[model samples]
Target: MEKVRVLIVDDSILVQQILTQMLDADPLIEVVGVAGDPYEARELIKKLHPDVLTLDVEMPKMNGISFLKNLMRLHPMPVVMISTLTERGADITLQALELGAIDFVTKPKVDLSNTLDKYEFEICRKVKQAARVKRESLAEQYQRFAHNQTQKPAVESFPTTKVMPKLSADAVIKKIAVPSKFPKTQQKVIAIGASTGGTEAIKEILMRLPENTPPIVISQHIPAAFSEPFAKRMDTITPMKVIHAQARQKLETGHVYIAPGNRHLIVEREGTQYFATLNDGPEVNRHKPSVDVMFRSVAQACGPNAVGILLTGMGADGAQGLLEMQQVGAHTIAQDKLSSVVWGMPGEAVNLGAADQIIALDKIPRTLLEVLTLLN
Candidate 1:
């Protein structure tokens, strides 16, 4: 098999060197070239024609964001962000994702050499996943983001308007099936788990939901400083009230509780009332706010009243927990392989016989809504 060719683009020669060594260590990855800045990166991109590009956030001549926007508009492909762990870096990384990045690997917070090896496995894995991303899917996302970035917004809504995809729910849903289990005495709560490509996937599903939709709890693998902004971003576009998970907030219809960064979001029920909590314990599957943690928690807390939906991602973090949810009579669904940027998580769930339905990304909302309507 041909190795996944990569180009490292960073202002720091040191980071570029370190990344080159680390990425080259993997037999499946080949660092074809390295560029000091976007200008050089552009030239190298045209020449090398690499499968993946690793980009830094801060650059000398043009910032990574500006270059990213331009690149998406001109020539789109899979790009992975290599970012610092600072607050500002976190925000920029999220912006890159919205701008059409496939995934990111956070730089060492401190003791660079010591911690660099810690992410060696992760960096290589992400690059491999990125190389597999369907170019058409990324191209479409870039077209959407680039189109919105340049257009002028209406005066009144300009302050808060976001560029959401124009795709309709009917375009993706093959068939909507109601849960076989009828409504129990308790209300049903939806639990969603995603990583990698999930940020946009979640946005698409939630934005399609009605204001009267069922309550939702999400475990989206995100960095420490990006979760709140993600929730705020979703809130601005979707009618559903999106909030970072609070210690004791009760789950309510039409509201979404997103797991805060660096913590796991879990649901616990006392009688009919379901509440969300943050778990600061050890990371499961190398992710805080792990889908496995949240899914397992939901299985114990909501049981038959829970509905699990696993979306696009690159790891098996949520697969086992989803199986547990299915075993307990909770309806479980996984995003179909074709629509996913990286289908690892959902594919694993389907492989484990965890999903009652395997649906397309756009169809998730309609299928979910159909499930809710079937219940009490």
Candidate 2:
């Protein structure tokens, strides 16, 4: 098998070194070259012709975002971001994703050497995933991204390869009892889960939704620093109010609740009302805000009153939970492979007979709204 060739672009010598080492450690990956800036990276790209590029947000000569814009517009390919775990970093990383990055790895803030093992797994896995992104799929995303950029100059919106013990949803929340009883409440709830290409996918769906749509709960794999900004960003573009989920927060019509990155967001029913609850439990499917946890909770709390839509992402985090939702008679949808940047999650759901409908990214909003109409 040909190793995935990678080019590292960072201004810091230490970062370039660390990234190179981490990527090289993976037998499936090879560091073809390293560049200190975008200008140097351009020259290296022409020579090395790497399969993927690891980019840093901060760099001299030209910032990573600026370089990324030029690269995507002129020569689109797989690119993964190296971002810090700060508010500003989160914002810039989100912007990079909108611009066409396949994925990202957060840089360690403290005790760098100590975290290299964990960081190694994350960076290597993302690079490999980025390399696997179909060129046609990436071109489609860039075209959409370019179109969105022209409309408004703003942000937009994977997977588990972990060295640590991979735990299932049971590690965090128990599975629903057999022959789960449907909740008596007739009010409907919408639950969405995604990872790799989810931020933008979720944004596409949310922006198209009517202001009067049902209560929405989303679980997108993200870090603690990024989820708040992501919710705020969605609030600006979408018609509904987007909020970071808080424990015991009431689910309201025309409002969206997003799980915080560090905690699991679960839906619980109290009498006739549904409330969002946060769980600080062990990571499920290698994600704190695991989609399985949220989907499972929704299945238990809302049953047939719920709608589960698994969007573009890597890995199989939400597949079983979506199946649970389906078994309870909830309408389920999965983003089609051609429309998904990485079809791992939604594809898994489809394979498990979880989705009632399979729709493209652009048509999901319409399909979801139609489902909402019938359910109501």
Candidate 3:
């Protein structure tokens, strides 16, 4: 089997060498070249033709963002950004994703040496995942997003220095599922799990849903400090109120609760009512906000009254949990392989016989609405 060729580009020679060594150590990967800046990277890209690039966000000659934009516009390829875990860095990193970068890895915020073990694991994983991304698919996404991005509501505007709003677990619960509160005993729930290309996929589902949708609990793989902005941004575009999950907050219809970054969001019940509960325990499936945790919780809490939808992502985190939901008589759906950005998660569910139905991404919202309406 041919090893995946990778090119490392960063301002620091240390970073270039360190990342090169780490990626090269992976038996499935080869370090084809290294560049100290985007200018140098541009020349090497033409020569080395590496399968993937590890790019630094901040660099001399030209910043990563500029190079990323030009690369997506002209020479589209799979690139994983190496970024710092700061507010500004998070914003740029998200922009890079929007511009068609496959994924990112954040440098340790404190004590770099102490963090290397974890960082090395993630860097290798992301590079491997990135290599699997089809360049043509990224080009399509870049074309798809370029226009819709410009017309978003001003409330969703970016780069704000203002204090991001405090999001309690149920902060936006008013008038969930409709203009009226859902009956506690009969309330239905929806659980969604996604990663990789999920940010855009989740947004599309939310944007299409009516204000009368059931209470939604989402576990999207995102870094700390990114989920808050994600929930806030989702709230602005969708009629359904979006809030970050807090411990033991009641789950209500017409509201979507996003799990806080780095914490598992679980749905639990007390008597007849459901609440969004936070699980800060050890990471499950290598993710603190693991989709499996939330899916299993929803299965236990709602049973036949729930719907589970698994979207495009890179791993199998939600596959077994979706099967749990299926065993409990819950209706389960997986995004069909044709529309998936990466078919790993949803595909696993399909193979596990977890999905009751398989549908395209654009069709998920309507299928959900129809299913919920029939149940009601």
RMSD of each candidate?
A: 8.2, 5.7, 8.3
The lDDT of each candidate is 0.83, 0.88, 0.81
Clashing residue pairs for model 2: 157-199, 157-200
Q: List the residue pairs that clash in candidate 1.
A: none
Indicate which candidate wins on TM-score: 2
State how far residue 60 of model 3 sits from its true place (Å). Answer: 3.3
Task: Please write out the lDDT profile of model 1 over residues 137-242, one tens digit for every residue.
Answer: 8888887666556863221111122221222212221112333543355478999999988898887788778777778999998887778888888898677799
Per-residue accuracy of model 3 over 1-376 as CA lDDT, tens digit each: 7899999998777677678778888999999998988888999999999999999898887889999989987899999998888877887887787788888888866665556557887889888888887888888777766756776422221112322132222221111222122234678899999998887789878887877677999999999788887787788878889997877788887899999888888887777788998877666666768888888878777778889999999878789889888887789999998777789999999999999999998778877877776665
Candidate 2 matches the true fold with a TM-score of: 0.94
TM-score of 1: 0.86
Model 1: residues >4 Å from true position, as ranges? Answer: 109-114, 146-186
What value does the lDDT take at residue 259 in candidate 1? 94
Ranked by TM-score from best down, the candidates are 2, 1, 3
**Worst ten-residue run, lDDT, model 2?**
154-163
Q: In model 3, which runs have C-alpha deviations exceeding 4 angstroms?
A: 110-114, 150-186
Clash count, one per candidate: 0, 2, 6
